[model samples]
Target: MGEDIGLWGVPLAIIGGAIRVSTPFLFVSLGECLTERSGRINLGLEGTLVFGAMSAYAIAYETGSPWLGVLAAMIAGTIFGLLHGWICSLPKVNDIAIGIALMLFGMGLAFFFGKSFIQPVAPDLPAISFGFWSDYPQVQAALKVNILFLIGIAASLGLWWMLRNTKIGLRIRVVGDSTDAARAMGLRPNVVKLLSTAAGGAFAGVGGAYLSLYYPGSWNEGISSGQGLMAVALVIFARWNPIYCFWAALLFGGAGALGPALQSVGVTQGYYLFYAAPYVLTLVVMIFTSSAAKTMTGAPAELSITK
Candidate 1:
């Protein structure tokens, strides 16, 4: 059956890989969207992600429950986010600089703590199999979806609705777009930014948990491979919209899957080059979205990147 599929399998495999690979992008981008929406940028999510992955793996290994591990990761992410938010709120401190420092700090902490868990096997998150009728094992494997992806989808929708409908969301948008305006309205811009940054970290941490507990399903120093950082460019491309973030993440996932899908069909030539697809796509997105003379549409007025 696999042989019969022939070259047709490439696209199928890509589709499967897209579903698998897009989860982390989906999460980190969405989280950044939240942070940027509040007039702050968090470059340290990479560290938060790695740390989350390590902690999730460790907790899950010790507790025998992946969900507990996920919770722990979220808490850890919140702490990291809070730290970033607090430090950035200090006078003369740069958000980007603090983020970079935190990223390194988070990664260092993760590595120091995660060394022992490199050899330990932890419980993995379960997937929902949607390809029950598939005759091919590859198809079945491709159809198996993780629960976190679904949660991310819901989060996107919920975030979109909140941003448009809720009072708190209005405050966040207000603070992000203009701190002075937020102050005029009696909103505490710093507090809003702090909470939003922390919330963003929580989301990034979940993305990391998904990495370690599900797809690629392991804890290691090399697990992230810059997905956390690339997500910043993705947020720019997504125009800070949660819905757009979802689609963009899937697009990135498809691009990332291309090389692997080709290799599955014995197309090993230039396979290493194909791995660069996501990074290339990120550059393309950044180039097309950015304008030196004009601020990006839908961008917060207070956002440093757009300035």
Candidate 2:
């Protein structure tokens, strides 16, 4: 009976873990998708994410409101995005280089200021119970869903619809395809890229907030664990589609949860190696999808990686 329960527990744990782990990925990838759709890449989102986490944690601790912390994170992310966009718009500036620099800068700021927040307790985001009908404690715990995850799902659908139907989406698509064409059509490419990057940063910031204010709920320097960087690969795997990003995030999340899920079932041999599953999957996806011979399918025409 115990073995049977363990077997059943494994799948349930993975399912629950996927939902919990995927929230940040979902937000970051969705943000990256939006930024790329406008023909700009902001690699500095890693920094933005860390800084946002710090900011969210600090604010939540001080204000006693997790929602305010989220708002602060968004604002901070927007500022970082604006800075990245502005710098990239200058003559002879490289967007990729700017992104890397900003990544370092953001992380530095986060570490320096976040030191004080390490020991403080902050208000956590609330979770909605979806397992009310279940009598099992494990099931109930597994089904306790965060509001941010649900919001991410809605954002995915909304982003997909906007990209397919709206005028702003049309502009983003046009800009991403060709700056020359965008200029010919009387659109300001720089402005579009600027706003898109800012928006993307905002999304990433929210992802960071989800990290410290919810799952793994704490303010810490290492909380991100390179998830922000991995989100870039996720965008590639999703082919810049917001809907696909949602699924891809969940896949990555499930992979991340594999180790813990197995451990719970008494499979401890090589347990630590399971933690590498997400990274391994990232590398595999990159290897198969990347090619020097041709542009990736669905990649933005003007994207630096594609070009």
lDDT comparing candidate 1 with the true structure: 0.92
Q: Runs in model 2 with CA error above 4 Å?
A: 1-4, 292-295
Residues 1-307 of candidate 1 have per-residue lDDT tens digits of 1354788778878888998899999989988999999999999999999999999999999999999999999999999999999999999999998999999999999999999999998999988999889788777877889999999999999999999999989999999999999999999999999999999999999999999999899999999989999999988888899999999999999999988888888876788799999999988878777756545989988988867
Cα lDDT of model 2 by residue, 157-256, tens digit: 9999999999999999999999999999999999999999999999999999999999899988899988888999999999999999999999999999
Candidate with maximal lDDT: 2
lDDT of 2 at 214: 96
Name the weakest run of 10 consecutive residues (lDDT summed) in model 2. Answer: 1-10
Score each candidate by Cα lDDT: 0.92, 0.93
Off by over 4 Å in 1: 1-4, 293-295
* All candidates: TM-score: 0.97, 0.97
